[model samples]
Target: MIAREWKCRVPEAHAEGFTAYLYETGVRDSSATPGFLGAQIFRRPLIGKIELTLVTYWKSLDSIKAFAGEDISRARLYPEDEVYELEPDVDVQHYEVIEHGFIPGGL
Candidate 1:
């Protein structure tokens, strides 16, 4: 099992919009792709520093490459994200899963 990670920073004002963009663009698209196991987004905010992290589980690097293309680095920006951060750069990191668990959502 593997979890791919990407990191970036954007202004707090653009946070919501950025999240919306992730859903519309990345989450929706990547989840639908083959070999896409799952995806999670995390945010870390400080007094004047904010960082956004996107973590995705994939079968393998080959699986990710198949969906995202040859140069698979950079956040796929949706039209909506333009209103948020002026520019977003993606730094990629891949991790091997040590352990994982999940609980069913009951409503």
Candidate 2:
């Protein structure tokens, strides 16, 4: 499995709008993608800023490539993102899954 993670710094005022856009735009598309397993979005609120992180699971590297293009290491922002993130510090990360755990104790 492959993990695709993105960290973004968004303006405090646009947090809600940006979060809404994220889910309505790329995430909705990604969720329906063939290799998409799951996605989690995180938020950390500060006095005047906010930090957002998106982590998504993919079945394989090829799946990631199809979603992110050949330059997997590169980061890009959606054009609609500009309305919320005036200055976005975005980062895309890739991880190699070594192992996964099961419900040893049961749910």
Candidate 3:
């Protein structure tokens, strides 16, 4: 499994709306993609900024490339994202998931 993460900082006032937009767009689209396993969003509120991390799981790098294009490390952006005043990282990080497990029906 491949773990991919992208980070960005948003103005406090716009953080909530931006998170919603991400879920409605990126997360939603990713969920429907082939080889996409899961996605999670993490957030930390700073004094005047909100730090957000979008994490996604993929079956392989090739799957990621299908979603992110030839340069899989590059961050993907939408035109509407400018409204949130996001300062996004230029590249995303990917890691090889060494170990992970979940109990069936635990939720």
Task: Please report the candidate that would top lDDT against the real structure.
Answer: 3
Q: Per-residue lDDT of 1-107 in model 1, one digit per residue for the tens?
A: 77878776778787777777777878888898889999999988956546778889999878888767766664455575556664456557778898998677944
* Sort order, TM-score high to low: 3, 2, 1
lDDT string for model 2 (5-79, tens) is 888877788888888888986688778778998888999987797888888889998887777778877665688
Please give, for residues 25-73, the per-residue lDDT of candidate 3 as tens digits: 8898878889999988999988899999999999999989888899988
Q: What TM-score does prediction 2 earn?
A: 0.83
**Candidate 1: residue 90 lDDT (0-100):** 51
lDDT of 3 at 36: 100
Model 3, residue 107: distance off in Å is 11
Alpha carbon lDDT of each predicted model: 0.75, 0.80, 0.92
TM-scores for every candidate against the unseen true structure:
0.78, 0.83, 0.91
What is model 1's C-alpha RMSD? 3.1
Model 2 whole-model lDDT (C-alpha atoms): 0.80
Could you tell which candidate, 1 or 3, scores higher by TM-score?
A: 3
